[model samples]
Target: MEHKIKNKVEEPFSFKKRLESFRYAFKGFVWLFRFEHNSRIHLFSLIAVTIAGFFFQISKEEWALLFIVCGFVFAAEAFNSSIEFLADEVSLEKRDKIGKSKDLAATGVLIAAFTALIIGLIIFVPKIISLLN
Candidate 1:
């Protein structure tokens, strides 16, 4: 006797389905840390700041700034990844305009990352100085 296999297709999602989607979305955060280079860097930076904040007694305002900067940098990196994926999907063959647009998107992320680095340095330098004092 031979057995036959059946293939089933899932239906389109409804509002409840969409809300349920968030469960998987939250899992993306874990996958992001595992797969994304920038996410790993951001996680490392967050851990470092958290340790410093505890040990050096960072002020509330400074912690706020650190959180904001770290969030901005990570968001920019995510945006850059989205742009690259979209651009690649839209133009599988490399066109000059698409290349330029992707480069511009990357530059925006680079600017955000650099700005965050400067902010981090400004916030941490004083803490380090005080520790030495």
Candidate 2:
């Protein structure tokens, strides 16, 4: 026999609900930084880069690029963490496919971080070498 499932009532959109969504997103952001070790490492790198940018007095364009890349790295890290959490929730078994999924998620973070590093070096290296002169 086929079973039918009842759908819950859909609530109407309101300004209050919109604000609550932002609150939930902020909570998740805090939780990610608090609970994830890799997130902390990224946070450290972000801080270091921001200090270097100020010390070097990076151009406005450079500041924009730095902000974009840093945001990308953080977003990638958050996505990877989410995938890991969801995978664990779905199954605790040592499955090959699950392992592969986690690895792929991590690879995304790695690529984002590496790209950010290259951009940072391109922007900062010349400034540093010139200061040495």
Candidate 3:
């Protein structure tokens, strides 16, 4: 017996759909801060970095680099959180494979955070040494 598959029609693009997508993304951004502990940590780091940038009077180019790395870290954290939530939904039981998946996702966030830290030190350490001298 052959099975007939029904083809789904694609919907035409609309401005309304684009607006809805932005709304959904904004909601997810709020949810990340509300439910994700590490996001809050990132927020604190962001604020601190902003303050330091101002105190040091970083050049426009340095500001751009800082913004890029900070954004990268947040993006990594968001991706890691989504993977964790999906893995949990798949199975609440302690499965080895699921645990490994979560670990791998977390490693992305770790790498991003570490890179940001290095950038911060590079930008600030020389200024600090000069200030002390």
Write the residue-wise lDDT of candidate 1 on 1-133 in tens digits: 1232222133554798777788877666666666678778878978987897888787899889888888887777777777877898998897998899889988987888788789888988987887789
Evaluate all candidate structures by whole-model CA lDDT and list the values in order: 0.79, 0.91, 0.91
Window of ten residues with lowest summed lDDT in model 2? 1-10
TM-score of each: 0.76, 0.89, 0.90
Clashes of 1: 0
Clash list (residue pairs), candidate 3:
none
**What C-alpha lDDT does candidate 2 achieve relative to the native structure?**
0.91
Clashes per candidate, residues 3 or more apart or on different chains: 0, 0, 0
RMSD of 2: 3.2
lDDT of 3: 0.91
Top-scoring candidate (TM-score): 3
Q: Which of 1 and 3 is ahead in TM-score?
A: 3
